[model samples]
Target: MTATYQELRRSDLPSLRREIRAGHYAKHTAGLGPGFLQTNLAIMPEAFALDFMRFCQRNPKPCPLVGVSDTGNPMMVTLGADIDIRTDVPAYNIYENGKLTGSREDITDIWTDDLVAFALGCSFTFERALEEAGIPQWHIDHDTTVPMFRSNIETVPAGPFSGKTVVSLRFIAPERLDEVIAISRRFPLAHGAPLHWGDPEKIGITDLGAPEWGDPCEIEEDKIPVFWACGVTPQVAIERAGIPLCITHKPGHMLITDIAEDAEVPVRNPRAA
Candidate 1:
């Protein structure tokens, strides 16, 4: 008999995360888990959960919260049936005094009783939706990580969680911009709409080739640079939040789950084409 998990082309996400957790794979999770939801992970102490939740609520554009684990628990039962918060993500960064000190594949050895995990919806999930909608993603096409940058735009504060919004940049042709906008808005759980287009410097980006995170993509003359609120925004916030200790999924390595992608609902944007 064929394994049920193996039968899924890109849909067998839980097993994928499990393999990633066990050190079977460590690479960018861009095109994997076609129909399932993938998220950014941020683990901090329960002491700051309320403020962080409010930070997400107040600044939904950059910090759309998708799932939260109970204090001291490594299980993210709500996000996936057997999700283990500490080991499910492909890679993790440990921070101390707001500085990244180390990286890990799993955090079970260091997991503490007071830690809480937050899973924020990521654009990878919606990008899969966009592909299904017949929109092309240039970064994927060029085999490069999506470009990201820190913006001049400030996020609403909740306690210590505050900073300028960081965004992932994509270049799309003029003919497809309208359709991209329409498809993205349907996934509000993820960063719903783009923040800016055309000029990167208008958002404090000095150079398109030099990115704060991820690999840079080459832009063609016919394509324009477009920016969207990214899940990495929380990493910037966690830095500003000044938490003595925190952990987050390394950029591009996400936590994939069992959500359907083709089930996207049509969303009409009044101001968008």
Candidate 2:
């Protein structure tokens, strides 16, 4: 069956993951999964799970630990119903020994018994909330990838997982800056709030038009550049760790979950059913 964006948007948790795992649809999930949780994915070897978890604990801004699968299991049942780590995301990036090897729609070939999956909450969820609040993201409106830059900010070091924090940039009207920050801070799991605003160079971003990942958005005359911690920071960290093998979702392509918007950001560690 053909899966339309509108159809995907309203699907319950198990149904959405099933559709993604089927491999027929592969597209940026920017505006879909309304009022639901969408996540950034990282699958790593068991050897690095403890250190990576510590890294997330120390650096909550860039690595808000949402859910972690049991060692060697791709099933993220804790996050929602029927969530599979293998093929639930739209796309996947495979890295070998600190270098990007290739990307795939599914990683059944590389699936191993030593792999552990981690799901990080994404700013996309908050961006959706902002839109619902009547504040639109320029990247979403322009149909472009959100601009991301490697910031000078360093994440707290943990074992082999330590690197510069990457941030997503958005251009917003000065009048809406207060509102944007205020609303975003409510969703702490979704990168919760902005790390910096106004000057890009202060954060080591030299060019606003050229992004390290994804497409760039225009900074209008009336709008000022705003930045938020991105979940992609782990991709950079995995490269630094120089692990033998790692897998992540492609930029803009994310794993949409069954958790409703209100349930997306965890209020407490509710045990998986």
Best by TM-score: 2
All candidates: TM-score: 0.90, 0.93
Give the clashing residue pairs of candidate 2, or none. Answer: 13-258
| lDDT by residue (tens digit), candidate 2, 164-252 | 99999988889889999998887777888899999899999999888999997776767888999999999999999999988999999
Misplaced by over 4 Å in model 1 are 1-11, 261-273
Residues 116-179 of candidate 1 have per-residue lDDT tens digits of 9988878887887777877788777765678889999999999999999999988888998988
Global lDDT of each candidate: 0.79, 0.84
Worst 10 residues of 2 by lDDT: 264-273
Output the lDDT of residue 184, model 1: 85
